[model samples]
Target: MRRTTNRSAHRAGRAGRVRRTATASGAALALALTAAACGDGDTTGPASEGEFSGQTVTVAGVWTGTEQENFQKVLDAFSEKTGAKTDFLSTGDNVSTVIGSKIQGGDAPEVVMVPQVGVLNQFADNGWLTPLSSDVEQDASQNFANVWKDYGTVDGEYYGLYFKAAHKSLVWYSPDAFAQAGVEAPDSYAAMMETAGTISDSGLPAFSVAGQDGWTLTDWFENVYLSQAGPEKYDELAEHNLPWTDRSVVDALTTLGELFAEDDLLADGAAGALRTDFPTSVQKVFGPEPQAGMVYEGDFVGALVTNDFGRTLGEDADFFPFPAVDGGEAPVVSGGDAAVVLKDGKNQEAAMALMKFLASPEAAAVWAEAGGYLSPNKELDLSSYGDDLTRQTAESLVEAGDTVRFDMSDQAPAAFGGTAGKGEWKILQDFLRDPSDPEATAAELEKAAAAAFKG
Candidate 1:
């Protein structure tokens, strides 16, 4: 349970939002919350006494498989506390398109788990999201950092409450590979490249490139750009206030080229990489045969390596921070799914209740105890996390405070940041294939960004 005192005024404002009224039931809920705090048997608080007994709250999101199952547990906890039936609708990859169609067809879900900040902004701007009530805001303020609030806010009203978070600046590698190569986890960009070269020189490909997934390329560019140009410049580029052709962009690309330019450093060369999707890329490094020595991605890769490949984190597989660049500190780039209420939903009251519950440490603990999940809730006990690596990762993000940033691509419009074979994604993949001309790549990026940001 890390804490920060920098946002005192913001926290004060949040504290002023709403105060709990004392009723017999409210007092009982408070007692239950206190007992839950003491690590008692009932961790999720007491079941509601027929509050919203017949209501069904539908939640739309992109989660499926294990992720869907884990999130359902959180919803179940909410249901138990509020006495409402909860239904989850998986919208697959095209969340915005599916949700938009549903809204237009008068069939919007009561809540939506939005994955991108840009998409959340679009929804909020279009008046499709309901403004969260004061009680919900106060709960969010108490349990989450101000940055989470900032992400969910639109024109001074909070809407989205982030439930699941991803720390995206990790580089996973095998300790055995590093030992065989006679190298160590790096502290700087140059050292990481040297490590890659050493690992490759030892008869294994040093890195696995997920070139087919254009979003991964965007992430590569973001980590470099953030470390090189710093936060203000990062914000400028993400918002398109600064052109992509700016020298900062070119510099970042050039720094990234230190790795991308070396064909020997990447597994199966650029052609093979271009055909590889994200899961295959991970498999190349941690799979049964182990084609490569390392892979870079978010903490989610831990789950894949542990579950699919039968590797143990901190043993067979582990991660290091994305190394520092140009004498600057490494930046923490993060992504998350925000929970927002639908403006036209019939279960507004129950939806708001769920939102409040989603903001609590108790709800966060549910997912944290389940593997492969991270929470932005500041008050969540680190012990709630199932393992040390997971707990440390969550602690790092929560303690990063003002220094932490959302994924740069996720902050941009989907056309530029998310779509495959288009905009930043395509431009970066092109850059990945041909690192000889970063200037031209920057120009292409500027062109795509200019067009996308105009919308």
Candidate 2:
């Protein structure tokens, strides 16, 4: 359910400007790993002086727009207090390329904003990240979820700390539209389908989806499968212990396929949606005289809509909890960004200090206000947030105990996630085109998943 409110939600727009200023203002871009030594290979605490003194620490991240701006504010505050110069490297595009070059050249930044937890493992495996035992111990609750922490740990040492969480299993819709249609939010999967059928019977698309990026569809499948099979099976699939052809997995795909088969159920045709971008599809659902009645996406989709389309979050759309699957445990699939300390930097202490500071409630609040992200820091009092939607999102996270971590396609072994991620979307598209043969589509996807996960 896309959650829309009548109240206007505010967000920062200074990300690009702040990044440009930070990068241009006297801070040097550290040489790549090849040009610099791995900093004595010492696992000791940060240095107190010399090369670290008056030295600028380069921080690389993929966050852009308001998220980047929010982080920049925090970094600016850190610089003001600590006198440690900082350089901002905004690698919005080609992040892997840039990070790979830095690690290979031995000039990786002191801290990096990692988009996926799996990347931390890959970095640790490649000796590109330092174990952040001190940081984790100092800020215990702010560390990664048990699953992510365990996954990110290399040789039993933690290397990354998550800073925020996004609730995915959320279905956003227009309350006014719902009222107009005289339909209440569905509480069960069967009811949800019935509601969709009713909405479609009115000649409106029941769900708004853009499958062009493929990841959007993947998100839907992940949420449904996670809800249907429960977290245990979800984890098994993530670890490749469960076959993609498992009955539960096929059932989930079939369920989604049935939704697709309903005429005019989705904003665009299955093939057209497969080619539409996320924002575009979302607009079709939230635009004036919305073409679709609902959209299933993460909490952050609100941000994308408000930031890009000048749409007010609360006034334009609202979200509801995804209905419970039949005889399945209710669990939310949550995704968020994390911070990591890169190896081979001179200002390690300063960077760690900055990281610890950023992990604090104060910093989290700053981020929440600036970027509209839900702070992962338990110590943060989210009540301070002025925006109702942001506060609601924060409350939802707290209310949801033990959320399942988001499965990034980049997190699994090289070929597994990326290939399977793409394959899942294709399967969805194929199933949509011919609902009579969901089993066949599921079988093809199972074969693809098997080959992708093959050792």
Candidate 3:
């Protein structure tokens, strides 16, 4: 439940004929995304970023603090090596509003890191984004899989390139706690329950579930549904093409219920879970002689453990992909920020230069070494990562390979996917509070989704 938003907005006008012409096409593009192992895609890297000496590039993103600081190193490298002036701006939480207002006022950054593909596509549809340049297209083809390249595609043209990627279906845990309690990561849902019971018996709550952030509850259900019910149903539920009350949806909820059933199973019980924010949920397990042994979240948890908790990764904390569901293969649920070029920018050459660098492995390695980022570029040297733990985490994402999907809720409409106090967020919070009536929960979820989707 790290901060998330749909931020859907109407982009007013289209620059006449902003679409780039396609020469040769790759495989037919489908919105479903999955990647193979390392060097999985048609891995290619450009010779070098273009020289944009004596010019400036304006880049905007939602990152701040460490993320922003680390990215500055990349931009600084580009500027120093190529003599291009670069400025980076963090557009707080209301990125859509900020960018939209800028667009209306005839002032927008040359490049923007869009967090949601669905929202980016809306911007693309309005012609505010320039389609990928030919060289950029070639770079994307060389460095990324078709899935990564296509995530940025709108109407057969690519508009965004994924610069930062995250593997969301992961459970962060304390290796020390697990070993001390003789608890092991489970392989299946049943094994998870048995393991939870064992860990709880050791006097620590087995799971530090975060109920305060309802999106975590959504992830809890999504990972199960994607693995157990498969992608088609997962997509349908996300788009609301399938009703929330569907048996498949209930099955996902019911499977998740196993973890929520007993008060002792949760850290500080349901009441605390309902109040504990995400970072605190992590602290509960990795904090001093903790109350819990595990907390499920995304890959960013490693950075949180090391940077926020003043702990080491491999020794103090580690993570395992969400276990298999009902003996089915585990699905890799991912979320990432993609960079797009604004069609209306004044510095197109400098902007393209930066995009070229981002699509390459060398620059990605810099961010990788800086520790708060993950890149979709398979060309990245695993050894460049600051620690083996992070390298392993990245490897796992690629290893799960073909069994990948963007977070379902993240791809849905804003009101349905990202809004608080309604839709999936609000409804899933209720589910965590009371798993006894999933059918009712499903009904309420559908009600919210139907209304929001209409909006």
Candidate 4:
């Protein structure tokens, strides 16, 4: 819930990330058909020893613990099949800083899992990354969505391949609470407002909005703006190409006020939301005598519910698409970690081999089974997932197609997007505390964006 807590809960999600392109003359698209002709699927079973034999490549990433253990299975398979050794280094929270320091120290790992598209682009621009090899480019293009492909590409060269993604436009609700309140989930923004009204009238709070976590509030702003203002406008705003005070933004914020404006609709009202963490936000909704009817956040919310809170998905807690505003379709705000190869790595072939391995369905399946992982690979076998609902969640993302957009805040500058207790985070918190004045809030947003973007 970065949007969530610091442990397993906080490793919430990522968007498009990728690697260098195969050719300055070729598009990532041109190789897709060729990759399909070669029958692209999870083929990482084993490999014969050759030029890369006995080579040891290192990978640095933010995941650890069971997540690390699960990923080790993939690494071990790579080692077994290719006769190449690979070691993983956890990059901690400051991956950009750590990678930058390593680059300066001339000791960069062969490959690094970059979490933010914005930061990845920064690396590519700085010429700190090696462009993708032809084989890696074709594999990514064939398997990943064009949006993801684009995220990895800069100046016509691919550098990051998006391996995983998280869908943020979801509202998790308690079926029991909805039944008790006698209100079904809403299919449209208007309907959701009405549903909340119904729940409030039935003597229950409607939403456990996590105002304590500014990222959650930012996601709240992102989804509403994306659906209401449309992707083009959303993109313009995300890149600071448009001002926050624009009518589309004002309209989205005004629309958000419909729910936030009502004190009774939120769990313990604005005061409670300000005090509630992400885990507690969900806990309050599904716990004994849930004070609220629902919670809105990324897919990790479901993971926490099933893993941490010990709740069943379909029976206890289920989510619906964050309904659209103004007759638009729901927007898919994708998130995840992206892996890239370093330009100065010692074992180039082994590093490329690891990226190629990760792009496969077999690699994705390994993490899927280990739980708390979701992939955007169309070739992945849904049956390999542990549960039906988890599979369904993955399927829902794949089905989103062109409607998918990376998390807007994630794509913005860190000061504007990533920093907590600053920029959009603080402004949005101010918003939940006072939705009646979106005009004032939008002005504050514009001021922050100008300073952050200009700085």
Candidate 5:
């Protein structure tokens, strides 16, 4: 729905984005946590008395509730550094349409925090995005991996920078629950299934499956596909260079069905799971009387467990990397929101300044210390994270930078990937409901994908 005219319908029930880590080896990088400034008046040191004395910058994004509050902390840092008045406008879930209408009315914000790469592509295609300045580009190159930069590029021109990252390849489980089952985290998918089976035999269902939220299904498929088929096929499928009906698609779906088809492995059987949304699924696993021992999703689940359930990560609950499919490196599927400037903005200088600041580790550390956040910036020290589990999780993401892939469905056309009750979301929901035939499921996915890509 990137270019949709029906803003209201699109806004009603859009799926929440579940959205990170470090370098190649499992070890943390040795880069200095902070770079020294050349002189006392160095602009990099911090905001001078009034760097941009009389400017204002407005940023729009789909973040609401706590996410919005955390993002505001980042903006507040930017304002304090540059002496600019910063404002945030929550676009709800329909950012594309809301921003599009604002642009049409000649009132677009100075910057937009795009939640999907698909929508960023849409905005870039519409000629609404301003090509970022060389300084901002250099700042991004220094802070982020080439993969993050690639997501913001359109036709060889960089237009944005990923400000926040989400690692979607985590499996959160109760430490006590794992001990009760007498099992540890497994490295490969086969071993994971065995672990789940052992846990289930110990009187608790193994996994909390959030079937009611179609996006969760897409994340599950993406991690398995990326692990089994590898990154090359992932890129091809994401771009539609490889059709959805390809053997790889069937293989991935079949692998996922190994979990979906097992009623006993799920917290609530298949029917109850189909009625369970994301938050409820988390509750079933982490609440006082848990029904399930584990749940699989992004690192954001850490925040929910801590804030909502008052559980401390690494003690009451913790997460492991989504297991490998065929015994190689387990794949890391990441998601993020990028800050892109508007070409028609009233204060281009201020917006670009904000963009440059957002690309710096200093800005990222502001939110990182606040909890429930991860950064793709290679230089940000893992210590900036508030907890040990978060530090280790962020380290894993950084370690996998060379092989990491963004959320697959997010890289597709919004009509196919982001929308609810249609295209990939609905089709995956159907597959979850009845995963008997992987081949048939792949065919249906291909049909929807082809039509969406064609449009």
Candidate 6:
């Protein structure tokens, strides 16, 4: 449910893609609120006084192209306003490796942008993150209270600040195409399926599901699970208390497999999904001759489509919340990037000051304008968004009183997340190619989940 825009799809092209060669065994941490011990209480070698006064803070993350351009504008503005010199170390990929190397070398950035929530906890556990409760206290409600008080906290301390959050569980479609096919916005999963089938019958593909990165499929499963099981079970599963073979998990995967089985539902046999790259697969969705009726992606997909197809969200695209399923409560799946102060940094006060500033409504507004990311600060007026689609998305956040955090795949233990993507996606792909043995596939996934959780 993280904001996996089309930009994430381009991660494969990151210049310094750090491929994790070592595979470990453990229950992948889920994006859930669980109590755990804090780090070793290591201060980054006694916070230096006025260390940041004349020093240029180096920021690192895997953002480039237009995304970088947008981020730089914000950084430039921050420097102009605060007179805090800043240097952005933009990298194409290998974000973890780059950050890890910096930390190991005792030269990590003052503030690091971590996209995956699961890794944040791991970093904190390793004494690699500095607590930020003081910053949080400066401005409380402006931050997404739950996310800050829960996921960003460990052992009663805050170590991260939410800058921007993305709404997932969004189904984007060509309004023109939907109208041409005589469809209405679906209010339920059943209605959505019926509409999809009808759209396909009208000679258009139903959905564009990119399974190459396997994370997209994870989003589908998480959304369905959230709708079917509600927040409690979702949180339990994320915390590793529930097994993947549970009825709810199986039910969600089964639902996705059924969608995949539908004729003309996904582009060219969804099994081909395993081979298509993330960017290419997304391009197919927003192509000139759009192949699918709808695409389930995060807010970032709009950027990807715009960058690749020169299509704007409102002109060529619009989105609907993924329809409610199993008569469950309605909630949106939201994800965003958080700035974690590394425990190894020498400028804790300066870094924390920057974080506090970032949490301010003013800074959030600037981020919205610069990066197209929804500000976590509720006090920030979104009236200036201008674009109808963006405004609608922002409104959805206000309306979503209970947001399911990012998908467990990204928030859970890395092993489980990876297995869920690689293992679960393969199972889904097989079922799509031929809906011959859903039970067997379900059993296999259940076993895989057990193995992952057992570790």
In model 4, how many backbone clashes occur? 18
Please, what are the lDDT tens digits per residue for candidate 1 over residues 1-455?
A: 01111334332322221112212235223311101111111133335564666777778888777787777777766666666766677788888899899888998888898998888888887889898888778777777777778777777778888888999999999888998999999989889988998999999999999999999988888898888898778766777879988999999999887788888999998878899999999999889898899999999999998888999889989899988898876878899999899998888888887777777777777778877899887777788889888977887777765566789889888889988889988887888888899999999988888888887
In order, the Cα lDDT scores of the candidates are: 0.79, 0.63, 0.72, 0.75, 0.80, 0.63
**All predictions: root-mean-square deviation over Cα?**
6.5, 10.0, 9.5, 8.2, 8.7, 11.1
TM-score of 3: 0.86
lDDT of 1 at 143: 70
**Which structure among the candidates has the greatest lDDT?**
5
Candidate 3: which pairs clash? Answer: 44-142
lDDT of 2 at 272: 62
Q: What would the per-residue lDDT of candidate 6 be over residues 199-218, giving only the tens digit for each residue?
A: 88888888877767667777
- Our model 5 lands, by Cα RMSD against the true structure, at 8.7
Model 2: ten consecutive residues of lowest lDDT: 13-22
lDDT of 2 by residue, 86-141 (tens): 67777664566788887778777787777765566667667777767564444534
**Model 1 alpha-carbon drift over 4 Å, by segment:** 1-48
Quality of model 5 by C-alpha lDDT: 0.80
State the lDDT of candidate 3 residue by residue for 1-455, as single tens digits.
11121111101111121112222222211100111111111211211443555556677777777777777777666665555666666687677888888888988878888998667866876678888778778877766655566567766778888888898888888887788779777777778788888888988888998889888887888899988997667656766779988998888888887678788989988878999888889989877658798899998887778777778887778877788898676777888888888988887866776777777776777778888777777667777678887777777665443345678777777787777777888888877788898888888888888886676
Model 4 vs. true fold: TM: 0.88
**Per-residue CA lDDT of candidate 4, range 73-180, in tens?**
666666665666566777788888888898889888888878887778778867888988888877776776666776677777778877778888889988887898
Query: Which stretches of model 3 miss by more than 4 angstroms?
Result: 1-50
Off by over 4 Å in 4: 1-51
**What is residue 105's positional error in candidate 3, in angstroms?**
1.4
How close to the true structure is residue 132 of candidate 2, measured as C-alpha lDDT? 70
Count residue pairs with overlapping backbones in model 5: 10
